[model samples]
Target: MIKYIDSYDFFACQLDNQRCRLLALPWEDVLVAHILPRLPLMQLFDLQRVSKRFRALIRLFFTKRTTFELVGHHVPKVAFFSLVKDNNVLRKLLLESCSSWLTDNDLLPVVSRNPRLQTLDLSGCNGLTRHALVAVSLTCVHLRHLAVARCDFVDGPSLRSLADHCGELRSLDLSGCCRLTDATICYLAKKCVRLTFLSLAVNENITDESVEDVAKNCRGLEHLDLTCCLRVRDVSIRTVAEYCPKLQSLKVKHCHHVTESSLEPLRKRKVLIDVHPPPRRDRLSLAVDCGPYVNIQPLSARLLPSGLNADPLRAHMNGPAKVSDPWKNHPSFPPVMPHLQSPSHLLTLHPSCLVLALRCSSSPSLWSL
Candidate 1:
């Protein structure tokens, strides 16, 4: 119903002036204020060919454009230039879809024109190199929210340039940017102290140094993502929990070194984390389940006679080895005496009693003992 109504209103302006005069509202006001804003960006170009009146009205609409979002759309070069031609008051420019063709030359002019740009989301824009970011840092000083996710070509220098210039940045997403290192992150943490949300997910190079700096410098941080950061350990997580009191969400998935020792405290504070704490177990059950501790030192075969067997000692030192127990079916030993049966029983027996038992078992007359 809405599409039909909009279609009718769109074609109504194409009619002769005498018919347009019959309408209650003015044609230009209706098209510019109501009709033009509803039409797709590409449709506006076709509307321009309708008449000189529409072309002028579309241009006027572009002049007042504040937010131009073409996310996931395959915008052609010529069409993109045409859409942003007269738009200078833009506050937000989201061109995540134009990554395939968006180059520095194509984006610089728009960035230069819109100095008041507060939010720019160019995530997955792999074709764009650091030059685009440099231009943005220089031109869009008011930039507060920036997302360059998966843009691996973005290096430390470009980020340093951004941190030095855009001190007001609040939100940043650098996830999957493998080229970035700890130096870049630490530098950004100190410079962009106002950052409230940051993601370094899938970047294995970042460690405790960078994260600790971020936690200390960006104390106002609310959300952080460290997913797949294999080098990140408990120290960094503990630092984050200590420094960032405002932290509401933390993603530490796939960080193998980060254990419950650090995460348990954050759980107490009610900070949402991607990983779960380990289940509790009593110390006695844990110790029994773990079995006896052994410190087996490496032995040299050169020190022993060639015919001598060292396998039994090695097996004994490293704890029990699976084998047929010679005393199990012996007529002198009772099967009901379970402690004197298996190799595992050695862990519980006293050293002197074991020695005495072995000595007594050597003689057939004392085997019953």
Candidate 2:
């Protein structure tokens, strides 16, 4: 029994020596390839707190990844700033809806550090100013996509700075930037020739001239939004159709002057166009005269005699009729009639009455005249 115990102790010592050799093996050579790729981003970030070796490995992993995103509301501001200040290899950074704590100073350090940034999205960052945008444009010369929508502080000078510096810019969103005008758009059109997607929705100051400038310069444009650009007319639509052959999608909602006729060219090219009808007031005014609704009585007792309707064209044959004429008392007749000799006379008639006049000339029996 004593000889058996000695043999068992010697076996246990050999097992302990094997365990020590396994633990002493180099983890960088064995574990990095097998473990790092499978780890979650949070886990990788936590690894940075383990030791200097771990921190170096995680930093190398992030540098190779080259993209980072942080939300201002969820992540602590100090942590985010520290990450931006530390990471030098990030190529894209998205700080969306970050108005809660993001400021110009925080943004300045980020752009200043990451001069290689190619895409930066600061959408809804209302706390940002013109200085931040100018700083980014100056620092990140390779920036291709930028979105500053709803940043009310962005104005003409900021856009001009971007146009001058970031010539490789491909996509830009200035939606809800109410201060933008034709001058700013013209500056962008002339400078950013590589722009492919642009949104200027809700900017009331843009006109056909700015659109024409874009058409003349930005040949590679694929998508455009001019929603609520009240000054934009059909001429701008025609200009885009004629020039931008690659245009795939266009939004012109609330652009009152853009009629269906003007959009035919774009449709023929298979471009997707989003257009909404004119307001109720304009539609009603064009189709019928609803203005005299208060004066309209029920037709039961208001109809003119058959004899009076029999010679409806007789009133037009003579020049302008007096207000005291028999037909003048008829509800169907307008309150006033101009001489019906020129084409302009048709303009004075209600649309319904105009159709009635035309029908009377072709077949008076249709109305039982």
Query: For candidate 2, lDDT tens digit of each residue in 118-232?
Result: 9888888888888999999999999999988888888999999999999999999989999988999999999999999999999888999999999889989999999999999
Candidate 1 residue 41 Cα shift, in angstroms, is: 4.0
How do the predictions measure up, each by TM-score?
Answer: 0.71, 0.63
**Worst lDDT window (10 residues) for model 2?**
360-369
Write the residue-wise lDDT of candidate 1 on 43-79 in tens digits: 7777677666667767787787788899857888888
Error of model 1, residue 335, in angstroms: 14
TM-score between candidate 2 and the true structure: 0.63
Model 1, position 37, has a per-residue lDDT of 73
Q: Using lDDT, give the best candidate's number.
A: 1
TM-score computed on alpha carbons, candidate 1: 0.71
